[model samples]
Every structure is written in structure tokens, then in C-alpha cells.
Target: MAQIVGIGLLVLLLAFFTVFTYYAPHGDKAMGALAAAAIATFLVEALQSFVIGDIFSLGFFQEAGTEAGLLSGVIVAFLVALTMGVNPLNAAIIAVSCGGIGLIPGFFAAYLISFVVKYMERKIPNGLDFIVVVIVIVPITRLIGLLLTPLVDASLLNIGNIIVVATEASPILMGLLLGGIITVVGTSPLSSMALTALLGLTGIPMAVGSLAAFGSAFINSTLFHKLKIGNMKSVLSVAVEPLSKADVVSANPIPIYVTNFVGGGLSGIVIAYSGLVNDAPGTATPTAGLLVLFGYNPAAQVIIYAVIVAVISGVVGYIGSHFFRNYPVRNTDFD
Candidate 1:
């Protein structure tokens, strides 16, 4: 009964979050900030602490990366507020208030508080607004973050537990589902990085997500070129970062999505078979995800799996392009 209720609540919360992202003002930007924060913090840690520090035995890089990871909530809140057009100083204050919380909770606090801060900016008059924000708004925002922290953490933890159990039960199947869906999200406005962070994905699930995303870069580039959906620059950009060519992908969803799903699923199977683990959440990005894999697994093993996934993804893209060769596509510009 409790499990059913938990599932129901998770669905409801996800639905609300989805609607908020679509309908709320600057919602997409706020979520984009989440991805940016993850890159700035977690990705840095993956590269610095894991790769540089652990591999090279350097204390400085390790300490710096660890510190950066600790500031995840601060960075997230700050960026979210700034993306919502809050004053820089005020954003810093909101970020500080959200200190000691996790990423998702910090985002919620900052996102909700940004509106109040905006309202006060209008009502409190120009010079006085900063004072009011520091005095009244800061503490309130912090309080909200503190209150939401446990709830958000608990919810994400539950979801993570479910994923862990599923992975244990059947890793290959979970890999297929997560890899495909997350790669699709990687190509969408909703960002795979943000989704993985929200779910607090770790272990094999994170491995699947990370590698699947890396493999998608090849898949997208190959598919775009073969299908003649965009120019050379756009195709290259999609390979580096699919979101850069989101309009093109969105415009030609049938071919792009199908190819990504197929390629990412194959890559997921490869990852699952290898049993590679990625402990870092939100590293479900291409370059960073690949680098982070080195942090967790044997370098040679990681390389072999990555190469296999990339090659398979490229082939999938090639085949998909041929299959959709005659299908009507909207060739888009880089601009």
C-alpha cells in the first residue's frame, strides 16, 4: 500500500513539475540553470577530484573539486535566480540562504522565491528593494529550502531505491528504458542532466545514463548528416551537444528520436553488460559523462565499452538515416 501511494505521489509530483516547466514564466530557463549548475559543480568534481586528484594523487584538485561539489545547492539557487532575472546581489543572497540543501530543494526554493522577490522589487520601490530583500526575503527563502530539503530528498531517495531494485532485478531491461528515455530527454528541452539530478541516479543506472548520452552525440551527428537534416555546422554542433540543435531535432523528431532511442538502448546494453558504475549524479552529459566514467571504472575497461557504444551508435544512426531517407524532413539552419 505504501509503495503504491509512493508511486502515485511520484507521478503527481512529476506531472506538476512538467506542467510548471511548460507554463511557468522562465521555467525552462530555471531548469536550464539546473543543468548548468550540475555541470559547474558535479562535473568539475568528476574531472578534478576523481580524474586528476585520485589518478594523479594531487591534493589541490581533489580539495577544489570536493569544495565545488559541496556548494551544489548554492550554485543551483544562484543560477536559477539569475536566470529568472533576479538582481545579482539578491541572487547571491538567495543562494546563500539555500546553503546546506541539495540541488532539487535549492532549485525549488529559489524558483518559488524569485517571484516574491520580483513582487517586492515592484512594490518596494527601487532603492529600498534591496534592503527589504536582504532583511525579509533572505531568511524566508532559506527557511523554505530547509523545509523542502527533507521532502525532496526523501522523494528522490525513494525513486532512486526503486531504480536500484529494478536494476538488481534486471539490469539490462532497466538500462534499455533509462538509456533510451534519458537520451531522448538529452535531445529535448528538459535536459538529461537535470532529469538525472532530480532523480539522484547513481551506480549502474548512472552508468547507463552517462554512456547513453555520450553515445547519442555520435548517433545524432551521423543521423543528421545522413538524413541531410542540417548544414555541416549544425551537424557538428549536434554531435558536440544535441541541445544546441534542439530546433532541428524537434523539427524532425521522427527520425532523430527513433535513432537516438535505438542507439542509446544498444549503448545501455553495453554498459549494463560491463557493470560499470558512475556514482556521480547529474553527470549524464556527453563529455563530462565520459570523463566521469574514468573516475569510477578501470580506464581500459571504460575505454573499450565507450568505443563499442560509440561505434554501435554510429551504425544505428547510419541505418536510421537510410530508413528515413525518403521521409520528409525539415532541414534547419544553425542560426
Candidate 2:
């Protein structure tokens, strides 16, 4: 019962984020901004600090990457605010206030403060609005971020721990669950990148997530092409990055998501046995995820496993398409 509750709470939190992305003002863009920030901060740091710097003993990359990782919250806060329509100056101010906070906390604080800033702009006269924002918004945003950081971090970390424990107990079961859900999320607006980052997942769990998404690129691409859902460009787009064709995928969720789940699960099983570890938190992206895999494991091992994952995903996509071939699908045009 306790385990059930914990799992349920994690699902509920993810659902809330999904709903919020669709309903909240500029939520989708905010999330896109968040993804970009994750790439800029986490991905860069992961590649540079771990792969290049540590491997080559390059101090410059190591220090530079560490600096980027440390500023993740500030970058997330600034970009999210800017994407949500906050002016550049005010966004920077809010971001600076979020310095040293965690990414999720900064995101929430900046997002909520954007509304306040906008309201002040509309209600308060221009001459005084800037003054009010300078005086009122920055500190409040910082305080909120500071207060939320520990709570948010703790909650997400607890969820990660649960997953880790489950994985240790039963690798295949956890692999299937994480692989399928994270891949489905990679196709959805919720974004696997954001999810993994927020969870701060590492080790086998992170490897599962990264490979799952990597395999999903092939799964989605093949599925999209075989289903005749869209033209070549759209097919290629999803192959490179599922989020690029998110609308089409959303429109045809049944086939796309179901196939991704199967493919991702298969890939996850491969990862579970391969023993590849990804210490990077947010490299669950497709291309980046695959590249980062080499950082933690040997080239030959990573290559062999990645090929296995790709073949499994590709086969799953081909087979899944035939199964769902007769199923009704909405055709979409990329142009």
C-alpha cells in the first residue's frame, strides 16, 4: 500500500505537469524553453565534464562544464520567463535572483512570477510598473525558489530512489516500465529530457531512459512512415527527434505511443543486461543520449548494445505497424 501510494503520487505529479503544459498560458513554449535550457546546461555539462574533460584530463572543459551545470536554475528561470512573454530585463533579474537554486524550483518560481509581472505591467502605469517589478518581483521570486527548492528536490529524489530500488529488485520489470513510459514521454509534450533532469536520475536507470529514447527515434520514424500518417519530411523529423512532429504524434497517439512502448521496452531490456551506466541526469534525448552512452562505457560494448537496441526497436516498429495498419489514423501534412 505504501509503495502503491508513492507510485501513484509520481504518476499524479506527471499528469499535473502534462495538463499544466496544455492549459497554462504559453505552457508549451515554456516547456520548450525548459528543454532548451536542459540541453544548454545539463547536456553540455554532461558531455564536456564527464566525457571530454574527465576522459582527456582537460581542465578547461571540466571547469566550463561545471559552471554551466551550476547555473542551470538561472538559465531555466530566465529562458522560461522570456518564453512566457516577460521582458528581457525583468527575466534576467528574476533569473539572477534564482542563482544557486535547483532547476525545477527556478522554473516554478519564474513561471508564477511571470503572471505577476504581466499583471503589474497591465495595471500599473508604465513609468511606475518597472519600479514596482524591480522592487517587488525579484525578491519574491527568489524567496519562492529558495523555499521550493528543497521540497521539490526531495520529492523528485524520492521518486528516483523508488525507481532505483525497484530496478535493483527486478531489472527487467523496471526496465520495461521506465523504458516504455520515458519513451512515450519523449514523444509527448511532457518531454523525457525534462522528466529525467527533474528526477536527477543516474546509473542504470539513466542508461535505461537514454537508450529507450534513442531507440524510440527509430521506432517513431519507422512507425510514422509505415502508417502513412504524413509525408517524408514529417517522417524524417520524428526520426531525428520525436518532439519535432509532436502534433502529428499527438493526433495519432494510439499507434505511435503503443509502438514506442513496445520498442522502448525491448531496448530497455537490452540496457538492463548491458550494464551501461549514464551518470548524466538529462541526456535522455535521442542523439545526445546515444552520444553520451559512450562516455560511461567502452566503445565496443556501447556500439554493440546500441545496435541491438536499434534493431529491436526497428523490428518492433515494423511489426507494430502491421498490427495497427488497419487501425484508423488521422493523416497530417507537414507543409
- In the range 229-304, model 2's lDDT, one tens digit per residue, is 7888878877777766654665577788778888898788779878899987777778878887887889898899
lDDT, each prediction: 0.77, 0.78
Which candidate leads the pack in TM-score? Answer: 2
TM-score, per-candidate, Cα-based: 0.74, 0.80
RMSD in Å for model 2: 3.8
Residue 29: error of model 2 in Å?
A: 2.5
- Top candidate on lDDT is 2
Quote model 1's TM-score.
0.74
Candidate 1 wrongly placed segments (more than 4 Å):
1-18, 181-206, 220-262, 275-283, 292-300, 317-335
lDDT of 1 at 85: 89
How many collisions per candidate?
A: 0, 0
Q: What tens digits encode model 1's per-residue C-alpha lDDT throughout 88-150?
A: 888888899877777778888999999999887777778788888889988898888889878
